[model samples]
Every structure is written in structure tokens, then in C-alpha cells.
Target chain A: MSESAKRQSALGRMMLDEAFEARVRSEPARVAEELSLPLSFVLELAAISAERVRAFRASQRHKDAVRGGKPPTKLRW
Target chain B: MPRASVGIGLRDAYVEPLRDLRDRRALDVLEVMIDDAQFDRRRMDAWRSLGQRWPLVAHGVALGPGDAIGLDREYVRAVSADLAAVGARWYSDHLCFLRVAGERGPIDLGHFAPLALDDGDLAVLRDNAAALREQYAGTFLLENPADILGFAGQGDAHGRESGRRYTAALRACAAGALLDVTNLALQARNDGFSAGVFLDELDWDRVVEVHLAGGRRSGGLWIDSHDHPVDEEAWALLEHVARRADNLRAVIIERDDRLPTLEVLLDEVAHARRLLP
Candidate 1:
């Protein structure tokens, strides 16, 4: 995953975590605001943590590759 | 005496058919796949309306419960919110971890790469289960993910019977099992084990639900693609399990990528109904 893709992935994870934290902590309004999303968006994807982890990992790899003289690959998810 | 009375895997194409089923009750339930929030909310009202009358189970694909790290509470919370919206009876995910520790990063599809079992893997599974139980507060069904034959050159004192040990460890921690019949069939064909025997080895009592999908033999192995119709042999096993296990909750038919028509999906459901005792 490229650096930009990595950033997007982090943002996605951040968005998802926002949603998860919002639900788990019982703070729907906060989750909604952080996600910049509506009430329903906060609900469907809250507990799904793996996708973000994969994206995060991909991004970290992108950075390492750049430092070690390797080209970047785009992240699909 | 039978499989959750009746059930179906929630599919995009079948929404209209399910809405139609609301008329004559051709379906009893739909296991909603919470792959994305955007896709789910679009059908939220309709899904809610369907579930009010018919039962629904929230089946998640990205819990990463098997990851060897702290639980992803964020993802769990997201799915929970959606399930609550639809009033789902329970929720589920795969037994395999989707993320793995990479060189200065995590590797996707790392779980598929077979390796020697270490204490860390087992610990992750236990924590994953406890975390899932904590997040959902209901039955957490962990599914058997698709696997391929690879020695993966594990270190000594790690590999021998790694597959069985890893799966057994997860079963020990999981609240219930979501054994995919097609996965067993594919594994049996590709991995040189009898599918029937494999199913027999499972903790049948803990098997709350059954997943049925179609696969085709490909690239020296059978791939568990949910695109086509459920195969005959796998369907037979479903019937057998329905007869053997008294606590079977539901039988879900899953299809992804290439979706079949509504009539075809309903026919598969009808086939399952006929097989049920």
C-alpha cells in the first residue's frame, strides 16, 4: 500500500474505531461526529476490526519499503 | 428436530426475493453479512422490517478475533451497532485471523500462510474469544476459514499436526462453531481427508449453525467460493448433521462474487428444507 493509501487506511481505521468506541463507550453522538457520518453509518461497521488492522499493516509496510529502496503497491481494502 | 425452523444467508440479490418471501413465508431467516456499513444501511429499513417478523443473525467478516494482539474493540462495536439496529439474535465471524505481523507492518492474508503453532497464537485466540464474548454479550460463532495445503516450512517443535492443534485451540475458546459444509468438502477433496470424518471430529454440540456454499475444483485444490449452487455431497452432509446434532440452530447458504438469481437461491433453500428432518 502506498503512503497515501496507508493514510486513507489509517483514516478508515480511525473512522471505524470512532464508531466502535462510540458504541462500546455508549457515546453515539461522539462516534457520529468523528466519523462525520450519520447515526446508521455508526451502527453497521462498528465491531469489524480486522479490515483496519490489515490496512494499517499494509501502510506500515509501504513506509518500510520506501525507506529500504522498494516501490509501493496500492492497497485494495 | 430441524434447522432453526428455516433460514437463509442474507444476499444483495435476494433482498427483493426476501421481500417477496414476506408474502408467502418462503424463507424463515437471513444471516446478514456486515462487510461494510455503507452497504448495510442502504437496506436498513427493509432489513429491520424483515427481521421484525423473521429472525436475523449478524454474521461479521472482519472481527480479526484470531489476531495475536489486543482485540479490535472498534470493529466489534461497529458490527454490534448494526446488529442492534436490526435486533439480531446473535453474531459470528471466521476462525482465521486476517492480519499478521509484517516487517514493520501487518501482513494481510498472513493467516492463510501456515506456520508452526506458538503460545502467542493460542493466547491470541483465547483473548479473541473473551473479547468477542465481552463485546457482543451473546453467542459468538467462530467460523472455519478456507485453508490450503502448505507445510510452510515451520520450525521444529511447531508444525506436526499444526492444523488440528490450531483449530482445536480455537474450538476450546469459541462460544460456538460455524462449520461451513462446503469448506469441509473442499478441504476433504484437496487435503486428502474424508469430509464426513472431519465433520464427525468437530464439537457437534457447540455447532450452533452450519454454512453451506458451492465450490469448484481449481488449481490442484477446491476453492470455497460462494458463487454457485450448493453441491450434492455437502448438502447431504448438512442433512446428516441436522439428523445427528439435536441443537443445530440454523443452516445458512452463502454466495459471494458471482451471485445467482433469486429463484435459484430460493431453490437452494428449498433443497435444505427438504433435507432437514
Candidate 2:
């Protein structure tokens, strides 16, 4: 991601975008049904995927801060 | 006898140092972080074997207030069983929510306030409290969390202001406060708020315990991940709070990430001990 583009990643501060959260909620079932993956595997994947996203945002924000950049503003609910 | 002045926040990482602290009389008390799997009879027996017979308060990371769904009954059951196993007096968890819907986070891994604070928030807690009451025979306490990005929706007062409101609400409920000074500083730095302001609003009368830790500022905002030395600001804050709260029970220094020597933590404990009332 571009550095400035990366700066928009708020520091683990994503409000449960009601819509986005709903999307994440349904992802495991969809992966299970479409990819023929085990439900447990899909659930684990979903969790790991979500954690990676949080970690990624966290890293991106950390980089921005280290380079003397202002962090992203808190997202309004 | 009255409680001691300063204490340390406990975690799995510090089990050895905790033993050392008890052995050397370094800490006044230690706040054991409540993990369901960590506290069993065998473990408690082993703890006793190691002479960890000092005063302790159990704190938790799984109190899922603010969830639309009710609390995770299994987790609550574990907490009760754990407290009974350890004979802990007061118990605490973050002032924010953990899981949501039913999926269990995005497993925020005990990150605080991903969800907004509302009446629903307190309701979920009250439900958990009722469940806790049914399972265990002790009172509950709460620790303020550091979420730089405050929940900016309905009734969204976080940081020290939120902590003040929390202090007010928990006071009304006749509960105890587990103030994490490091978190207060992390919140101040990240949220563009004032730690002093938060403390000024705090009802010291309700504070029963305090937690101190060093946070990593890697993520623009600070992480409450207990590592590094107790920063100067947090230590100063802890001393100020310790002096003001007459009912303050124990102060706990927390270390989670950067594994320092026991000597380093012992020194930090000494810093805390010097300020003890």
C-alpha cells in the first residue's frame, strides 16, 4: 500500500462498520459452502484473517507515526 | 489490616517474577490476570508450594459488556471457578466490550472498546455480574481500558472522561476500580486527551486497586501490551492516585511484551514501593 494510503489505516480503531462486520460474519459460511472447506477450518481462517487485518492496520499506523506523520482520525460511527 | 500501597498486574509471563517478588517482599500485592486455564487446584497448590501466599486480586479480559448478545456464560463460569480456586477478593476486566454478535471478535484478543459504550454496555455487564454472582461468592471490579480512538457514538465518553463516568457509574453500583495508570497515559497520548484531566474527574473514593505497565507506541497509538519500564508519566500518575484514594488496595506493575530481567521489574517495584502510603 502507498505510505499515505497506508496512513488512513486507523490504529485498531475500526468501529464495527455494521455492514462490514456483517460481511465478515457471513464469510466463513460462504467459504465453507463454496470452497468445500471444513467449517472449523473456515472459522479459523476467518479469525486469522481478521487478526491479520488488525495487525496490518496496526503496523501501517505504527509506520506512519514513526515517520512523524499524524495518525488517521478516529472513524465516526 | 489495611491494604498496601502499590501492587503489580499479573500475567502468565511473570509467574516466575511474581514468586520472586513474594520471596523478596518487593510487591505489596499482585493482581493476577484471570485466565480460565491458568488457575486450577493443581496450579494453586503449586503456587502455594512456591510460597505465593500473599494477597491478590483477580482481573479478567473477557467481560463482554456492550454486546448485543448476552455474556459468554462458559467464560463467566470459568471466572467464578478461577476466583474460588485462588481465593481472590476482588475481580476486574476492561471497561469495554470484547466479543460481538456471536463470532467472538474478530477475536480482538482482549482489545478494548471496539464497540461503543451504552446502556446496553452496562446491561451486558449487569447480566455477567448476575451470572458471576450465581457462580462465585465475591464482588466485581473494573479496569479502565486505553482505546485511543474513542467510540464516537451514542454516549461516547472514553479516556479519562469516560473513566470518570465509569467511576461514577461503578460508584453508583458500589463496585471497585482497577485503574491502569499506563493505560491512562496511553489513552492521553493517542486520543489527544489529558491524563491529568481524567484523574481530576475520577472518584478516588471508588478506587480500590491500581495497575501500572509500560506500553509500546508502535501503532501510532500506544498498545496496552505490558512491556518495557513503567514510563515516568505512568509512575507519577500511579503515585498521585495512590496518595489520593484512601480505600486503594493494591498497585500492580504489569509487563507483557519486552521480557526484562527480574532485576528491572524489581527496580520498578521499588519505585512503586517508595511512593506507597
Candidate 3:
């Protein structure tokens, strides 16, 4: 990954699409002004949101496992 | 020199084998995952018998103390009762939130998630950790989970955030740390930093325990699967921690997937004994 790519938040990479990145890059000042937060805060919020989404998905998977939605267990090396 | 007690996670898959080991007094402590096993009726009786022989530590995955909404009181009370019954040395959980309110009720993420290395995350951990320490007896240690995916803006510039967050969390909560050596190696592998660099930034005085495990690299990121044997990188990190962390007392090998035979697990435990101070 490029240095800039590495700097992009994990949430921005995983959850946000290219269009969102393009918008942020194109009008960072306007976007930051509209959000009433720094551009860095916007990225931070996205990262936090990504973590929340991960927790929610993991919770659903656990619920499914509890309800016997998983396959039979077996050991695989 | 204070030496660290070497043990393994008493997973259900290895319970019978561990029982044999327990009878022989081959292990020091068995870190039991609190939510993975039951603690009533015959099971409780069985645990009481085992508790008489071997030391057990309660490790939690679903407690999610880092949740903004505060930890679940019911869960804390239940864990306390179970640990007391088993005579556990301490209780610990990852420094991340697992559950959040859903439409129905609380949803528990079975996996340990990562928290943002920031001030807001630090506040949540500090508050919840203090509350957990108050509600539960014995020691409460916090472990840093694997940061497989390097979060946004936490590249070279923000690499120091992790150590900063860990330092602040320990200082604010005044709790011990369960430093998972393998997780640190995994993070360092994926995030382009040496594990030692991250270790150097932590307040080693707060670390009370260490965890070593095996992991695999997929898509250039190392995942802490705990299925394979302990690798060299993890062992090197464990050695580094042993040399620096003066307060370290316990070292555990966590193997949940593809568990090998009892002999093989014991070999890993022996390896830990050789590396620890």
C-alpha cells in the first residue's frame, strides 16, 4: 500500500467506498466545514463506526451459533 | 529473580487431557474462559475438586467492559460467583467492547474486538475497568487484543497511539495488564513496527501476565488463530517481555483451534518455562 493509502483509516478502507474517499479528497475543507469537525475527526469517527459494525456483526454470528446455526464442529489443522 | 508461572488455557477440548496433567501436577495454572464452560451442579462439583489441586484464572470474552454504556452488572456478578467457587486467582478480559444494545437486547460478540487508540476509548476503558475492579474480587487484568487491521490514520505517524492508549488506560484504571505476546507480534507484523518498539512504550510495571500463542499470515496480515504451535517471533517477544517486565507473574499459552495432543501442549508449556524469568 502507498504511504497515503496506509494513512487512510482502516474503516475508510473497509467500510467506505472509493466515492466517499474521492469526495473527501476533493472537498476536504467543505466536508469538514459541513460536518463541523476536523478532517482528522471525520476519519476517526469512521474508524469508530467500523469497530461498532464489527462488534454488531460478531454479535449476530454468536447469536446464530447459540441457536445452532453453525455446522458440526471438527478439528482442522 | 521472580519467575513467571507457565500455564495453558484450559479449553474444553483439552479438559480431559488437562485433567490428567492436573492429577500429575504438571501445570502451574489453567486460565479458564469463563463463558465457555458452565459452573453449576455436577460441573461445579467437578471444578471444586480440580480447584483443590490446581490454580485457575478466569478469562472473559463477552464482558466487553470497554462499552460506552457500561458493563453488564449481571454478568459481573455471575463471573464473580463462579470465580469464587473455583477459587480463581484473578479475572481478566480484553480491552475492547464486545456487545452493544440491539433492537431486542444486548448482543454479545464472541470475538475480542479492537478499540480505537484514542482519548474517548481510554475514558470508556478506565471507567468500566474501575467499576469491574470494584465489583469483582481478586485482580482484574486487561489484555490488548490483536490489531490485525491497521486502523485508519494509525500509520507511522499515529503508531505511538497504541502505547499511549495502553499507558493511559493502565494509569487511569490502576489495573494490571495481561500482555498477550503473540498479539503484540501480530500487530507489529501487520503494522510495520517492531514488537519491541511497542513493548518499549508500555509501562511494564503494570503487566502481571503474558500470553503466547501461534498465528498464521494471510493476505500479508498475521491472524492470532491460536491453533498452531508457538512460533519463533512470539517466543522472541515473550523473551523480550520477560527481560523487561519486572512485575510479570504468569505466562499462558492459549490454544483454541486445532489443539494437538496433551504431550504437545505440555511441550509448549515447557518451552514457556525455559523462556520466562
Candidate 4:
């Protein structure tokens, strides 16, 4: 994959996966190297607060549920 | 310029309430999500009927204009048909990418993803916005996403520089801005920038509409949940922009989740109407 695609995929993962987001928060450089993303992008991902990640993840889940015709999980504020 | 009209986003949960508001002449316009009615003929007919009573504006959620993979021509055509069916006044969509190219096909992120804000992304956005504008043949507005997660690129750490760059990008594309005040407030609180400074950096004339909504605090960060009442900070930003944006034509109260009673939204609409020049 190209560098841009790599970065976008990593971002996509960060939005979809809780564990991956935690790993990015704790070890940004390693994740950056693993994904071939710029360290700067990883650092930015690291700076994202855990609450924001959870909210984004919940939103994605809600959208998925809606598409599947399932009831959405209530998001905890 | 005419005084900006105040309105509310169209929600299925509030259709009856909106009809009452329209009858009472309390609502000015209705911003409908084109995607919601695109696939359902019944829903499209409902929106078309609503359009006969109130002027409708088209807002899309899944266009992903900033996506590098390129525009979804099929989705664009569908949205265009829906817009025409409802006689929409203008069209608007978020300036962030919602889809990415996957090996199988395009993957929908299901949420707005912040752009890298580099030259390459700007070029993609410019080309897409121009194409969409030409296709719509009417006012096309790009809304700033509520960027909770900051991206590392050609901008200052506090997000002011990013705001400036966004304004310049909109100007270059010759598309108007649907300046969402709630998004701006969320970015300021989450990214640690002066919201006033960010507002000042925008080219006021290009800002055609303003979105006002409430958000909740999560993990010490303000999330654009749009489930609460319009916060004071966002209201202040709305007032500030209302005074400055001479070309501002509309202000919409956007409440997507946890919708309250119609009276509550009407109050917000009234408050926003009072702020207009």
C-alpha cells in the first residue's frame, strides 16, 4: 500500500478498534513503524483522548447497527 | 443582505412537530439529509411533501468529498435525484473523508475522518468540491468537521492555522462554507485553540450557513454528541459569526441523537433568530 493509504488505514483502525487505539496511545512510535506511517501522525493519534476514541467507536458501531437493521447500542456520555 | 433565517434539521422523530412549527410560521427552512431519503421512495415522497410547506436544503452525510479514492458517482447521482425531487435550495456536506479505498472496494468509516491537511489532500478536496458544485448547479457548502482527534500536518498545534488553511481551501474551490459553530467550539475545546481567533480567520463572506448544536463532556473533552442543549460557548460563537458573516443566509439547529421535544428545538431556533442582524 502507498504511504497515504497506510496512514488512512491506521486511522481507520484507530476509529474501529479499542485495543489498537490503546496501543497507539501507549506506544505510538512502534505502531508508527509497524504501519509505515509518519511518527508525527502516530503522535497525533497518541494525543487523542481515550474518551474521544470511545465516542468515535460507539458512533461507528451505531452506524453499523443501523445498516444491519439492528437496534443501536446506547452510547454512554 | 437579507436577515438570515433560522431553521432546524429534519429528523424522522420530529416530523409532526415540524409540521406544526411550519403551520405556526415558527420555522424558516428545513435541512434534510439527502441520504436518508435517497433509497426509500416513501421517505422521498414524505420529504417532497414537506418541501411544499417549507423550503428544503440538502445535507449529505456519506459523500466523503475529501477521500483520495475519488467521488462515488453513483451516490452523487442518487443524491442529485433526491435533491431535485425535494426542490432543495442548496447542498452541503462535511469536508472530511468518510470512506477509504480498501482492497475489496471502498470502506465506509461511518464517521467523519480528519484529513491530513497537506497539499495533496487539499488538491483532492478542491477538485471534488468543484465537481460537486458544478453537478449541483446551485450553492454548495462544505462544513468543517468536529475534529476531536488532531492530525499532524501543515498547521499550528492549537488548530488556528488549520482553520486558516481550511478557509483558504474553501476559497480556492469557490465553494461556500456551512460553518458549524458547534464543531468550531468542539475543536477549540478539544484542540486547545481560541475559538474567537479561529472564527476571525474565516472569510466571513463565504460562510453561507451556520450550524448550532449542543455537545456533552466526555473524559474531560467536549464531544460533538448533539444530544444536549446548545452550550454557552457555541451560542457565543454563533452570535459572533452572525454579526460578522454578512452573506450568512441560514442558521440550523442540528440535533441528531437523543432528540428532545419540538418546543426545545423551537426555543433554540428562536434564540438563533434573535442573534441575526
Candidate 5:
């Protein structure tokens, strides 16, 4: 992948990362300060990430509930 | 094609408010989020109903027009069909890529990724625009994405030197520029340039639409969140560019999250019209 493409991928990954989501959710003010953005903005980012996380988790739950415990092939994130 | 002098981004959250404003004609045009309601029959009916009162403009987020993959064939066709159904004559999306081929097949980036402002990227954009023009038979504009981090090749840390790059990209695409004033404000705030200085450098004639949205500061960056009212800095920048963007046909107020009431948004739209008028 090209350098720009890598950077783009990294950003998307960061958004989908559960750990990163937790950090943002737990310490929005610190994240805001570290990124030089307002707390509200940080909260918004957390909210978006949280929504995505919920959707992913819900999909996971749905898969686990069916399919005889076989791992699903396609992750929807 | 006819254009709206002032408009607002249509959101499901504002459905009732929009219904209230339907007869009043408070908005001259409505920018439909094509991706959200693409194949839903009920929503399509709603859009058709809205179309009766106001002209619609298609705004998408997942077309990935600037990516190496170019315009997704199915996505473009869906958008074009819907636009035609609604009698819209213009289509737009951010000049950024959101999906890429991954080892697992294709990965969807829920966020918009900034394209490098260079000859290669410009050529890709041009090709995508040409494809869109041929397929949709309508004016297509590319909106600049809010940059949280500066691109690799764009000069300086703040992407301050991107004025020519933006102009060049639009020229290459032969597409109208949908100038997102607040996105530029976020760019300036994060990258160390005055939004006014950046706006002054744009070739305003290329601008076909002006987007007014608000952002908030988080971490150490200003995000183009579109959740709050238009900020003072963005309004000032709009005032500077609104006079020179002679081709400007639409001024859209975009608020996606933490949405104010429809009346409040209509008031903002009124304020935008006053500024542009």
C-alpha cells in the first residue's frame, strides 16, 4: 500500500479499535487535551465510536447465538 | 439546471420539522443523504414527497470517488437512479476515499480519508468525475474533507499551502467545488493557518456550493462534527468567500448530531441566505 493509503487505513483501524474506544469513552477530557480539541468534540468522537462498537458487538452476539458456535467469516466493521 | 440559493442537509432527526416547513418553503433546496436512504422504499417515498416542494441535491459519503478503486459502480448507479427519481440535477460527495481492498477482501472506512493533493490524485479525481458525469448526466461537485491530520505531500504541517492544490484538483476534475467553510476552519485551526487566509486564496469561481457546519475541539484538534451551530470563525470565513463565489448556487447548513430543532436550523439557513444575498 502507498504511504497515504497506510495512513488512511490506520485512521480507520483506530476508530474500530475497542481499546481506543474505551480510552476515549473513559477519559474524554484527557483525550481532548492530548488531541488539542474540545471535550464536547471528543465526546462526539466517542459517541460515534461507541455506536460502531455496539453494532459490531451486536453482530457478534447474533453470530454466536446461531451457527453452532462456528466462527463467522465476515466481520462487518 | 436550476439551483437553490440556500438549503439544508436532510436528516431523519428533522423529519417532523421538515414536515412543518414543507408548506412554508423555508428551504430553497434540500441535500439528501443518498447513502442513508438509497434502497429503502419508504424513505424514497418520503424523498419524492419532499421533492414536490423543493429541488433535491444528492450528497453521498461512501462513493469513494477519489480512491484508487474509483466510483463504485453499484453505488453510482443507485445514486443516479434516485437523483433522477427525485429530479435532482446535481450530485456531490467529499473528495476522499472511504473504502479500500484489504487482505480480508474490502475494508470499509467509516470515516473520510483525505486525498493527497498531487498530480496523481488529481488524475484519479478527474477520471472519477468524468465517469460520474457520463453516468449521471448532472453537475457533480467535490467537497473538501476536514483534515484532522495533514496529508503527506501537502506542504507544511497545517496544510496551509493547499489552496493551489485544491484549485488544481477541482480544475482537473472539471467539477464544481463544494466549499465546506467549516471544514476549512477545522483545517486552519488544526494546521496553523487563518481560515480567512485560506479562503482568500481559493479560486472562488469554481465554488458551486457553500457548506456551513460547526465543529468542536477535542484532544488537540477541531473536528468537523456538524453537531453545533455555525461558529463565529466559520461565519467570518463564509463572509469572506461568499462575496467572491459568484457561481455559488447553494448555501447548505449541515448539522448531523446534537441537532437543534427544525426552526433553529431554518433560522440558520435564513442567516446564511442573508450573508450570501
Candidate 6:
């Protein structure tokens, strides 16, 4: 994969997977090495405050609940 | 120039209420979700009826134009057909990637994902926007995604400058912008930048529509929850932009969850109409 794609993939995982995010939050350098991401990019991820991440996750969960655990199938008028 | 029209996003729960608003001359337009109109015949007919009554604008949630792999051609064709069916004045989708290539195939992220804002992503957006405009045979627009989680390479000054250049680039390719003022306010609040300065730097000539919504503060950041009423900060920013955006055409009050009475949203719409010069 290209460098940019790799970064996107890693970030996507972090956003979608709670366990992965936790792992990254606790051991960002190790995770970066395993994912072959640049140290600079990993540092950026590290800088994202835990509170912000929690807020984002909470919002996502709320959205899921609003959708009733199903992907958007129709317009909710 | 004509005054910008005010509208509300049509949702399932607001059908009768919207009809009432239309009869009362409180609504100027309706923004329909293209995805909802595509797969359901009954919904399409309802949207068509609403379109006949009020000017319709098409908006989509899942057209990830920023994907480097390119847009889904079949989906684009379907979207174009839906837009035609509804007689939409314009079409828009978020300028972010919702689907990404996965080992199995393509995976839907179920929400907007911020783009990298690099040359490659811009090229993707330009190409996709061009293709969409050609297929739809109408004006295409891209809404600014609410970047809650700061993406890499999007530092404050550099990111704002890159966004300006990218907006200009998209405009050059015939795609206008749908500026979500609420998202801008949230980003400014979270990132500690002056929203007014960012608006001043933007290529407003390319902005054809504006979205106003309400959000709540949570976990140290303001989330674009779209459940509450239009907040003061967003309304202030809307007022600021309304005075300056020369080519602005429409302003939509978007509410997706915790919908209040239709009268409440129409009141907000009236406030938006008052802001237009």
C-alpha cells in the first residue's frame, strides 16, 4: 500500500475499533512500529487528547443507537 | 442578485408539518436526502410531490468523493437519476470519504471521515466532482465535513490555507461549496481559531449554499449532534457569512435527530431569511 493509504488505514482502525484505540493510546510507539507508520504521525495521534477521543466515540455510539444498530437504510423524516 | 432562499432538510417525521409550513408560506425550499429517494418508490413519489411544491435540492450522505480509489459509478448514475426525478436545483455531498478499500472489498465507515487534504485527495475530489456534474447535468456541491478529530497534516494556519486553495480548485472545476456554518463554529471552538478570520480567508464566491444546525458540548469538544436548536455561535457565524457571501443562494436548517415541532424549525428558517441581505 502507498504511504498515505497506510496512514488512512491505521487511522480508520483507530476510529472504528475501541480496542485498537486503547492499544494505541497506551502504546503508541509500539503500535506505530507494528503498523509501519512514521514516528511523526504516531506522535500526532498521541497528541489527540483522550477526552476528545471519548467524545468522538460517544457521539458515534449515540448515532448508532439512533439508527437502531442498523446502517442507514432510509431517510428518517 | 436575488435574495438567498431559506429552507429545511426534509425528514420522515416532518412530512405533514412541512406541508403545513409550505401552505403557510413559511418554507422556501426543501433539501431531500438522495439516498432515501433512490431505493424507495414511495419516498421518491413523496419527494417528487414536495419538489412540485417547493424547490428541491439533493443531498447525499454516502458519496465519498474524496476516496482515492474513485467514486462508485453505479451509485453516481443512480444519484443522477434520482436528482432528475426530483427536479432538484442542485446536488451536494460531504467532501469526505465514507467508504474505503478493504481486504474483502469496500467498507462503509457509516460516517464522514476527514480527508488528508493533500494533492492526491484534491485530485480525486476534482475528478469525482467533474464526473458527477457531467452525469447529473446540473450544479454539484460539496459540504465541509466537521473535522472533530484533527487529521494529520491539518495544522491551524497551514490547514486553513490548504482548504482555501482546495475550495478554489473545486470551484474551478465547476463544483460549488455548501458551507456548514455550524461545523465551522465547532471547529473554531475546539481548535481555538477565529471563525471570522477563517470565513474571511475562504473563497466565498464558490459558496452556493449554507447549512445551519445545532450541536452540544461534550467531553471537552462541541459535537455536531444535530439534535438541539441552532446554537448562538452558529447563528452568529451565519449572520457574519450572510452579509458577505455574494453568490450565496440557499440556507438550509439541518436537523437529523431529536426533531422538534415543525414550527420551531420554521422559526429558525425565518431567522435565517432575515440574515440574508
- Best model per lDDT: 4
B89 in model 5: Cα distance from truth in Å? 2.8
DockQ of 3: 0.08
Q: Chain A TM-score per model, please list them.
A: 0.33, 0.33, 0.31, 0.75, 0.46, 0.68
Residue B40 lDDT, candidate 3, scale 0-100: 30
Taking the tens digit of each residue's C-alpha lDDT, what string does model 3 give over B1-277?
6687888887555666656763454678778777654433445555566676677787876687667657888878777788787788888878765554333444444445566645666677777777776767588888888764465334443456677677777776677899988887777766776666566679988999999888775544567767689899888888888998888888998876677887788888888888876
Calculate DockQ per candidate and list them: 0.02, 0.05, 0.08, 0.29, 0.06, 0.27
- Report the Cα RMSD per candidate: 13.9, 10.7, 7.1, 3.8, 9.5, 3.7
Docking class of 2: incorrect
Candidate lDDT scores, in order, read 0.60, 0.58, 0.66, 0.77, 0.69, 0.76
User: Tens digit of lDDT per residue, candidate 4, span B150-259?
Assistant: 65322334566767877876875677999998988888867777777777678887999999888777656666777788988888888889888889888999887777
Clashing residue pair totals per candidate (backbone < 3 A): 14, 7, 3, 0, 15, 4
**Residue ranges of candidate 4 with Cα displaced over 4 Å:** A1-3, A18-36, A46-51, A62-77, B20-24, B152-157
Better of 3 and 4 by DockQ: 4
Which sections of candidate 2 miss by over 4 Å?
A1-77, B1-5, B11-23, B36-42, B50-52, B102-110, B153-160
Model 1 chain A, TM-score vs. native? 0.33
**Which scores better on lDDT, 3 or 4?**
4
Q: List model 1 lDDT by residue over A39-75, tens digit each.
A: 5444433432444333334433432342212234323
Candidate 2 C-alpha lDDT tens digits along B1-277:
3645455655445666666554556655666656633434455554343334567677766665433355666777776777777778778776765443212223332345443334544555566556656776676777777654443311224444565567655753356788888887876776566677778777777788788877776534467666578889987897788778898877777765566776677688788878777
Poorest 10 consecutive residues by lDDT, candidate 4 chain A:
A68-77
Q: Which stretches of candidate 1 lie over 4 Å from their true place?
A: A1-77, B38-40, B110-119, B151-167
lDDT tens per residue, model 3, A1-77? 22221222222322223455454556666656764556774554344433434433443343334321233222110
Model 6, B1-277: lDDT tens per residue?
8989899988878877665653647878899888876545677888887776789998887788876666788889988888888889998888777666565666666667777667766666778777777678888888877777765434467446636754754664568889899988887777766676667667878889999988888878888888889988888888888888889999999988898988899899998888778
Q: Which candidate leads in TM-score?
A: 6
Q: Rank candidates by lDDT, best first.
A: 4, 6, 5, 3, 1, 2
lDDT of 5 by residue, B100-126 (tens): 645565676555666666666777777
Error of 3 at B119 (Å): 3.0
lDDT of 2 at B129: 57
Candidate 4 lDDT over A25-61, as tens digits, reads 8899899888778898788878776776776766565
> What TM-score does chain A of model 4 get?
0.75
